[model samples]
Target chain A: MLILQKISQNKTLAATINQIHYVVIIGEGLVGGALRDYLINTFNYKFFYNVKTPWTDKTLIEAHFNELKTFIFEKIFNSQKTELAAPSFLQLSFVWSAGKAGFAASFTDIDEEEKDFHSFLNLLTQIDQERPAFVKMDLHFTSSAGGLFEGQSSVQEDSQPHPLRPYGILKLRQEQKITEWSQNKSYFHGVIYRLSTVYGRIRRGQRMGLISIMLQNGLHKKITPITGDLYTLRDYVHSMDIARMITSGMISSHKPHKSPSNNLQVLFGLSQKPTSIFEIKAIIEFHLKHKIYIQFNHTPGNARDITFGKIQPPFEVQARDIRSGIKDVLTDWYGAHT
Target chain B: MEGTLSVSTITPVYCGAQYLEELIKQLERVRQEWQSKNYPIQIVESIFVVDAAKDDSLAILKTISNNKAYPWIKVIELSKNFGQHPATMCGVLYSTGDWLITLDEDLQHHPREFIELFKAFAASSYDVVYAKPKDSVHQSLFRDWGSRGYKKLIAKITKNPFVIDFNSFRLIRGSIARAAASVCGHETYFDVAICWFTNKITTQKLSLEDQRYINTGTSSYNLFSLLSHARRLIVSSQTKILRLGAWIGIASILLSVALGLHFLYLKIYDPEAIPVRGWTSLYLTLLFMGGLTSTLLSIIIEYLSSISLQNQGKPLFFMVDRSSDALIQKFLNHEPIDH
Candidate 1:
């Protein structure tokens, strides 16, 4: 009964934002880490991401969100420091980049990620319920283009998502759940970003995309397994470019033209260049000055081509080309390792 | 090919350093011509696949591609030479357009003729339109005759009537081109693999000249490479000749059986009707053994062909969207196209 009342109260809050005080990141993986780095170092924004907390654990996740709430409240309400110009309405921006499932993930793994996502959402709901009536909350969920649009060619903004695997289904469900969770809560603004094949940055213990894996393996002269055909096309976008776009979107006060009834903006993040594995291999080999050993073992998940068209305006950001991006990534890896 | 429809031009480069500059110049003129005319068509990208040519082709291509005058030119340099067909396939796989046009690097196929190819493709419901040379491509009787004879003989052998019409200068529907290129294996002939998807192929006659061949009496194809091309084409095709062999084998077996029965009847009824002493037994034995060998060989060949096709990644059904082609047809017919 208490939970029901809290949910009902949270659903009715009006969304009016004048300023943002606290920026929080839920996941610190590839995209999350890049976003966090950009916000803290580049933009000098007040971004909070707790690495020690296990977000997937149901019991600990609630406590983690509570701690985050306390941290934000202390920084915004208790402190004299002004994160932003003093305004009547203060808002909180949450960038949810927390997903453990990938294109090749099993059903069990995807199910676990879904549960983690729900727990995270429940915590957000709790925050909304307990927050002062003046504060607004915005969420930016990083969805997967490779998953949601797998087996699709020339994917446009209006293309209907037909998820072929559990990973894609989970992504689609997350998008729907976010929409539902923020429904009628004008105080909640949601932006769902469907990102294409992201590659760059070699972080420890975090999974990397094909480009990174090929570069890392190339340095060691290790044989890389090719799971897709040589001609399978994909749109590759850099992680930093994603970080830049998300950061700009979060900071910009410009809202979409859509009605505030839903208060949700769905955008596709892509480079709009459909490149093939054969081309990618050639580029990498050219940059590395040595042939990267590859063994072809086509997988069901990557058997089809997933190419994205030009992203719509107002949400589009210039993405780095694959050739120069690969060069930069390889050079960075080489500098760090050798 | 339609309102805001994009096209990509691909050239497989191998020892054409001298012609790269002129080729780019011509392509640029075409690109400008299309833009100024506003024919609802755009040359979105021009891809050059450098097949690790033995000359200065790669260097020249890189320099020209990096020039600000031709920003749409994309140069893909392979680590090693993968031959012309593979290089072209590599470029096709990288292309993102509604239509794809492939030509040679030596400027044998003029960029001006691109409009002719487009008119041909748009005028019909064909997925592939080849720019057939109305005159001799090399203007050398021996060379032209050899090329024609080669295609004719291969077409007769493989029983694919479209073989004689295949040319390097072609305009292929982008989807079919990419699909075919995607399925091409190391041994799969790119043109033959493309035919597996759609049979809506046509040809447009165009006056073309091999300037390099005429200037230097040398061409990209030599005796060895021509043989290799023939082998690859035949291997990639499901030759009807093999089926004919099987039928012939069965007919021979039936005829041998009839003759054996007749010989037995003659011996039983009238021994004097037999002209030779052991001719019947010898003749039947040879005929039966020959038939059995031919039948076994044909079955083996058929099984091998099926396995080869499967390994080549032949798609069961490829979906194509011709809605854009309608707009292209309207534009060609001087009808107003909706933006």
Candidate 2:
């Protein structure tokens, strides 16, 4: 057995594992940043969040990954041992499961979607290979539920994923590869969380997240158009709720003697309620105390509506109502603007 | 006002996010000014083709496009960092206007000077009008001289008359610009494609400043980028230098043939006139071999040049609109010659 011990500190591997939980979150975009903030503020976990900086060359990405690996190793080696029981290593990554829509717009062109999947798989492989020694690491991977299991009215953790779009197909492939890889590793506790339409206050001018787009347009007094009419339904979940559920799930259970067959687990991080675009717009208007100008177009490229099953987590997690979430987002956005 | 020609301005952005806000503001001001004047030419859209900039230029472009003040702003985020010319061509392909203007995202090409270019076009029948700086260009002396020398060399080598006056800040007719852009391959020099389409190209003198360089004290283009541009320019034009090689080959062959005939005449008619009998034969043999080698090499070069020109879409014959010369001469007489 490879024992990872702190050379400078008087601590055994098992004792150190019991003391502090080190979490490394990769791709510090909207979702990753929110999770980091929630974990730090609520649970006070030590985190090594890797934020992508603007790079001009390909070598910079490799350099950054090396730096992150060194940092993770050093953190694991220097942590003090305690008597409290907790998992030692935790890794989370937020990836663009849908990729750039323009590249995957045409269903016939699977090249870009394939490229996104390969890169995603490569990152997972790197994580699996570069994890700290002598520690059972709990790896929580987040993917888009809506983007993966497309054309389904209701989706569950065990739903037969039949994706119609190239983006969805690529995401499903990534999930399968992760599952296969996790089942082969005994010490790796991999949980795949398929999140629904996540919304919150994002950076201004960001084109992602429907809620952010509507709010930015409203603030700028521009008419926002809803493609494929207002009846497009989606399970809208707040980023805060997502962060809470993920953190709770990470801290909830530890089964040490689990077999390779049961090493990988799947969860749906979704709100059971499904809201239409019309309802969302109405909620935003109520929160902002003004009517947002909206127009609907009969476009064919809108994402197929999806419903979520009950979010059965090992621990109890409460999700904010859609209206309250919108209110919170608006308050934050308004505060930032003012 | 209804029948006025609409214009679309295209700027290929690469690491110019710092000045993007000011650029958009100036563009908006120009649009408003044109609207107030009831100008016959109106800027219908300002298309920004962001070539995966190293900075947050895409974000800035998105912000500008989202602004309510500039309804005509369009941002095209390219998947990769294609060079400026290819990015400009991408924008031109997406544009819908009567005329298309291509400029840099940096304030080097001032938005206010669109009026001057418009006036120049109005005065002439030229389809393309380039805005050339009359005073010193806002770049290092080395860069300015290097660019001038490269352009002159390219013009002389390709026998292309319009390349010497080629500038990024140009106002081109919409249909011609789009058609030219559509035919451009990955290796096509965009300016050469414009020249291939029309010879009715002229220049307007302007006093422009590179504000970005002034602020940052650094240029976006370095030695490597200039060399890449030079390579593209040479590849996209016909190799008149190769043709010169072919001419030299033909002249050598002719000279050798004339000398051989004279030697044969001397051997047949005046046998005693050759003082050194073996020397004459040796000299003739050397001349024949040298001529043969040069002729063969030149032919190979000529063949290679033809292949390159074919790939570059060089047509055997193209129609020219000579009637535009009268309007061009009139415009020239009215315009002041730049020193």
* A233-273: candidate 1 lDDT, tens digit per residue: 78898888898877666645334453545467788888767
Which lDDT values do the candidates have, in the order given?
A: 0.78, 0.67
Give the worst 10-residue stretch by lDDT in candidate 1 chain B.
B312-321
lDDT (tens digit, per residue) of candidate 2 on B123-227: 657789999888767566765777788999889988897888999999997656765665566888999888877888889999877776666667888889888
Candidate 2 stretches with Cα past 4 Å from truth are A1-338, B214-217, B268-279, B289-304, B314-339
Best by DockQ: 1
Model 2's lDDT to the true fold?
Answer: 0.67
Docking class of 1: incorrect
Candidate 2 chain B has its poorest 10 consecutive residues by lDDT at B319-328
Candidate 2, residue B158: the lDDT equals: 84
Candidate 2 residue B2 Cα shift, in angstroms, is 2.3
Top-TM-score structure, candidate number = 1
Q: Native-vs-model 1 lDDT?
A: 0.78
Give the alpha carbon lDDT tens digit for every residue of B182-265 in model 1: 667788898998899899999999999999889999998899999999999998898878888888888889989999999999
In model 2 chain A, the worst 10-residue window by lDDT is: A1-10
